[model samples]
Target: MRANSKEQIIEAAGVVFERYGFKKTTMDDIAYAAGKGKSSLYYYFKNKEEVFEAVVAHEAEHLVNEINASINVSKPAVEKLRSYVNIRMKRFVQRGNLATALNDNFLATFSFIEKIRNNYRDIEIDMIGEIIKEGIEKNEFKPVDTNFIAEAILTCMIGFEVPLLTKSNATDESVEKINNVIDMFFYGICT
Candidate 1:
């Protein structure tokens, strides 16, 4: 089946952005990659930023879909939480470059980019909150403020991104760290 023009543009843009980094990628490069003229590209995306935004959104959607699938698999809340964190961290590590680029200070300055980032975060937190709520309902986890706990869990994951995504630490070590966190989350550090 033939891909639609916008899908084709977004796919080409992802390749260009991944290869060149956001700062160096140009609209012409994406247009060329997509085998479309500049005017045709403009018809779908007003600028490189717009194209990049679409690419980021596309990537975010993919991540969310994966997380949702993982969550849907039969498991208790504790197991779901562990699976969620493991899957999320693993995916982030796989997309380390893109994740780092999105978190860059310069990119943070763009309102559109910031909005996209915020939207992705909110969706993730909501998903996590659902898992926590389920755990509580099932009596597998102690009752807590779902929103607060979800946000906190996500914050901790974000904090680990530097080392986890950068490969500053070994992948097994990072996974161990996540497991440790999940353990502490389910059972307090107190002896």
Candidate 2:
């Protein structure tokens, strides 16, 4: 699709930010990447921070949509939970390079970015909580505190980011590890 000027600028800014991270990327770099003049970029985005915020929002929305779609399919709760973890891990592996960079620095100093991250986490937890509720209602999963379980699942998934993002290549081993975590979550570690 043909993106508008503002969308073009945001897309270009995402690329630049991913390459150089939030602090190092300049408006000029975004303008160059977008093939627009610096003034045009400024006209679209007041500054680099605005563009970066837009990028984070865009990525977060994309993730939420993907997770929702993955779980929305007609499947058992166990299947849905497994799909959720796999989809989340794959996306993290795909986008985590840039995300890790932005998170390591911007998450501490930028309250706006921090809010965006929290909002994303909240959305994820809500989605996972709904699945857990369904599982309990259907007797597929034992009755547990859905909120607590959702939060624990989210936390465990986030923990995978460190090892998954650090890998130069996401091999089958990465997929196996994520599935193993899901298995442990569902069935417990003890035989």
Among the numbered candidates, top lDDT falls to: 1
Top-TM-score candidate index: 1
**lDDT, candidate 1, 66-122, per-residue tens:** 878888988888888888888888878776334744577777877887788788889
The clash count of every prediction, one per candidate, is 0, 0
- TM per candidate: 0.93, 0.88
Which segments of model 2 are wrong by more than 4 Å?
Answer: 1-3, 96-98
lDDT of each: 0.82, 0.79
lDDT of 2 by residue, 1-191 (tens): 33588888887888888888777889889999999899987776787777888887777777778888889988899889888888777877776433553347645687777777778788888988999999999899999999998999888877777777788396457767867887787899998
The positional error of residue 152 in candidate 1, measured at the CA in angstroms, is 0.9
- Report the Cα lDDT for residue 56, model 2: 79
| Residue 191, model 2: Cα distance from true site in angstroms | 3.6
Clashing pairs in 2: none
